[model samples]
Target: MDSSEQQDNLTESSGCAQAALFGPFQLIMKDGAEVLISNRRARAMLAMLCLAPDEPIDRDHLSRLLWPGRFEAQAKASLRQCLSDLGKLLAAADCDLLDISRSRIGLKAGAVRTDLSDLHDLLTEGKYLEATERLVSIGAIPLLDQMNYGEAFDDWLSVHRQQAEQRLQSAVSVALSALEKGDNLSEYARLSSLWSVRHPPAQTIADRKQGKVRIAVLPFKSIADPADHGFFADGVVDELITSLGQVPQLLVAGRTSSFQFKDSDKPPSKIADTLNVSHLLEGTIYRQGEQVRVAVSLVDAESGFESWAYCYDGSLDDMFAARAEVVQAITNGLSDALKLTEHASQPRKLTSDRKAYGLYLQGRALTIRAIGDGVLPTAIELLEKALEIDPEFAECWTALAEAEINMTVFTPCLDRLERCEKAAGYAKKALCLSPQQAHARIVLAFYAWTQNDIIGALDLAFEAYRLEPNNPDVLNRVGSFLLYCGRSRDALPYIEASIDQDPVNGRNYAILSGVHLNLGNIEAAVEAGQRMVDLGFPSLWLAAALAVSGDREAAIETYQLTKKLMNTVIYPPAGSAPLNPDAMDAYWLMAAKGLWSGKDQDRKNYCMVLEMLHATLHDPCDSTIVLPAIWMGEAPMVFKTLGTQITTANFFAFMSLWTNAEPINRVRLHPDFMDFVERIGMVAAWEKYGWPDLLPKPSTII
Candidate 1:
């Protein structure tokens, strides 16, 4: 009712004005009419909602409160009918039900007026002292005084009561923040994040930019037909797909989506089209004596061409690496389109450090943990200690430097210049002392990459690969570099080598997914992507990969999360380069496009693409360590000189460790960058780095 209206006399009449009385009974009134409810039990129920101004009261607990220990079933039925009748009584008198839910007895706040609400609202609005005094008179009602008398409704009441207290406290907190002279912004942000985590938004992750790849994996036919080996076939196929899908660029199909057509004798091209893919992969599993023979083939959809194929023969004990071999072969087949930079062989040094070398390699192996979880400090400590004990141990020192570099890449708490220099020192020392050592060269290349010295990074990377082609680690690194240069076709051999070396590793899986997706093998990519996610890898890669597979639903949750936590996607300390610049545009655009494989899902994961692009662009310049970028080919566009963005015109040279071989930055300083950016009407560049920052910014690059 409008408070400014002409005063209506407070007297009984046919036009009811619903007013719930607390003491011992319930009554409804509106427009001067009154409906007095004589039952104390019903009134007690009404009192509960009246006390809670805008909160829900559970129905389960209401039954127990009204009837105490008796007539739960009948009382619930009776309560529902009574509430309905009460609703009509209030409505007939022109009262509105603010919220009437089936779960609990809730007052349509508009339908009635209660003194308790006035007090609560007053307190919530910062009149705490006045509200406290009002509570006394309101809490004394005979029916309301029996609130905590029963255990039946205790849980629900306890929950709501706590919520109310929290809301009240939150209001007080907001008011206090405003009143305080100095702000505690960090603390406030942290607390809000805590609350957000506790109760996340409707979407956990945002949509990713979709790529096209509808890939699938056939369930491996078991040669071990005995029921005891029932899990073998499924495990191998899934493992292969899982390892391959870890690359966010692929659109690997899910097992459920692929296995349904398993063993159907479908031709590779036919299967590829059925799955709406440009490429198809087929494999078979067989066991002979103690050895397992696994063969796989990659086929082109257009010409029904057999692009590539390979087979592995190993003992049952070696099954762990079987999937990697298959993945490598498929990647190899698509080598023409996807430049996978990888080495040709593994290191031949049959040496181990007392107790330190094994642990050192193990430590090196654990760097850059799956999404969200940073590498353990213990791993870094172990690598550092190993190096200390064996200063002459070039590999150990190299590993330590790499670890430090990775820390800086993940978070700038590590000194970028100092760490990269130290990494270079260790890696160079290793190379000088052990010229033939592939791992040593790899270390040097890593440091060079950090310094934005593209040529130096590539030279050392190739040397490492030539020296140890079979080393999966080296292969993965080389493939990553090739991918960065847009020489994806050249990257295939390296990735294949790595996968052939260690198929089960998530890195290899991720790499394979990218290779398949780039080759337009949609089915292969999706299968690989889903496999990556299901096998305990981080959801970010899987989400992005699956999003590329046209399954936007799977990637949607994580994509939403990626946006809210935008910091995760944007690298810190990008210096003067704002993300929206044209010089950085291609790197961001192309990489973003390729990173996600499925068209539909990628559309859903749009934020991920942007953040990914931002991270990719920023990481090359801002990153002190290039190993993580190496492991995740997302660093291609991010590569930059230590201090400057290189240009395409000067593409032939490399002055630092962080620069792209192609000199992509020059394009940005060209007319194209300004024209394109102006059209987009984006001011992000202005916000981060003004126009002057890019103009004649040549000297700042390196």
Candidate 2:
């Protein structure tokens, strides 16, 4: 046959040839014979083409990447020779897979199939279960294993490998979510365990099962008018959960999770199962005028049998004693029923005055809700009034600190550092009054983190955890601090545990999203972000997660929603104008810049608005202005900002420098990174508490 006829015949049979790039590189012919390409550059070029399948890659770009240091003419000449050799090799193997042109190169359409393409097809078809099974069977193997062409090629390979892993993880996340929605618990557990093997939690299953008693205290049903007594009932339940969490052997479900069942129709057994607890404590409260009555029962979750029961009647005037009696009775009953040692420590009352306690409860409720315009300020006012009535109310002080810390973010018009400093002061006062207040410690830890005191922040967070291991807020805070310090693997277990304990709290999910994003679980991050939004908390972090997940439209929508929420928070109807208009402008500008930085197609349109906003801001350090530059991978801008920060000893917005995002990773890869970390005390922090995952150990940092 002639050459053209032979080519036609080869083309007819080419569909049978396949490339496997998920692990080792393989080129299989029609007869399932492996055709070896011994040339390393040829193999890399083939892998690159296979990555994009039938899409064209610029010939110049390919040459530059593979022959990075060569002159343009020499590189192109080498590329042509490499292509000729590769073509001859493929022809010898009876495979015709290249679609070469003068300007571009790509794999021939329908000429080769890849394992990655097959996996993507399965994912596109929504065969998540099959995709997950296939991924598990494939295991945690790197793509194009042991192929290191050069620095440029290695960087390209690293990005592609990460993308591959992200795609697989996204499939797993989708499968898990589907299984959960379908109520397929057995399959969910099996799949979750398998996935967990690849990305292990900080605490192992054995560590979680170390002879601990798990219990959930449900919010008491109110028999009185809810509007008048709901906060009191919630307060009592909150206090009970807090007290129970202090027991050494107890693992109490968080108040947010327990309260999720306050109006639930689910039976106690089901609620207990959902909370992953062996026992459930539930009750009813009735109050009329100054009189109050409480009735409670503890049930075995598995058997659905009542293990203990109690009732108490007391005046509202003696609320502290009444609450104490209820807590003590439950603890004693639990000890007897479960054969556990009784905790001897008594619950500390926050305030002696009844009215002060009432006001504190109301304010705490509003603070926890954290929804509407002026809610935080109103909560602050009520809490301050409570403190006025009883200046030594430690819990009230902690609550005030929490509110102020929240205002640092939610109230854009306020001075950010001023709020943080105020929160620190309140936290300090609370610690002086009650040294064991974990909430106060958490607040102080957050403040310490803002000031870039990594050592002090971690110490305070660890102390808070030791004080109340099962407190969900404390767990989330500690996890957040760890994440900020670039200890994502160490942060994962705490964030997951916090979510398990407080599943309904949007804030917990928000932190979980950050942990997942830093760990490179894009789909899980987006899912967690969506959950936060579904729980009525629109977040810029959610928008960022969506953008990272490649859902640009959804990300833009979320960003718009966040702006609206911020507007409401800053310019509430009937509320005073912003105390600092520039601060407000700075806040909005930073958010806009973040959104703009993530968009490739929208940048041209967004540039004008960004410039306008930038022109309006007087403070150079305002709005975390360097963050957008970092996100855009502008190393010079980042270095310049850091230089100023280092000179002034003020590192505003440097908290996120340690994250594992690609932009931050690129910054870390810069030649000046070691010097930067040393100057910023990150090196010292790493030496004290181990190095971050992305950075090399001190000895290796030449």
Residues 1-702, model 1: lDDT tens digits: 111110132232222233333222234443343445444445556555655656666777666666576677887887777777766755664656536566755654365554334434664575544443433233212213224436655554555545644564565456446434346454443333222221111111111114423345566666753642434555456445544444334445544445546667777666666555566666676876667877766667778776677677788666543444545554544443434343222222212344465456456555534123456455677777776667676656656666765655554342455665776677677666556666667656656554445545555665565454334576677666554443344456666555443444543565666655555455775666555555544334444445545665655554434433343345434343445545344443433443343343532354344445445543343332222222223223323221243222122122111122112233333444444333322122221111121232221122
Instruction: Kindly list the per-residue Cα lDDT of model 2 for residues 370-448, writing each as its tens digit.
Output: 6567888999999999999999999999999988877665554336567788999999999899887888887787677
TM-scores of the candidates are 0.34, 0.63
Model 2, position 251: C-alpha lDDT score: 80
What's the lDDT for all of these models?
Answer: 0.47, 0.69
* Cα displacement (Å) at residue 174, model 1: 81
| Model 2 C-alpha RMSD to native | 17.2
Off by over 4 Å in 2: 1-209, 225-227, 300-305, 539-601, 604-615, 618-630, 634-664, 670-680
What lDDT, from 0 to 1, does candidate 1 have? 0.47
User: After aligning candidate 1 to the native by TM-score, how far in Å is the CA of 261 from where it should be?
Assistant: 29
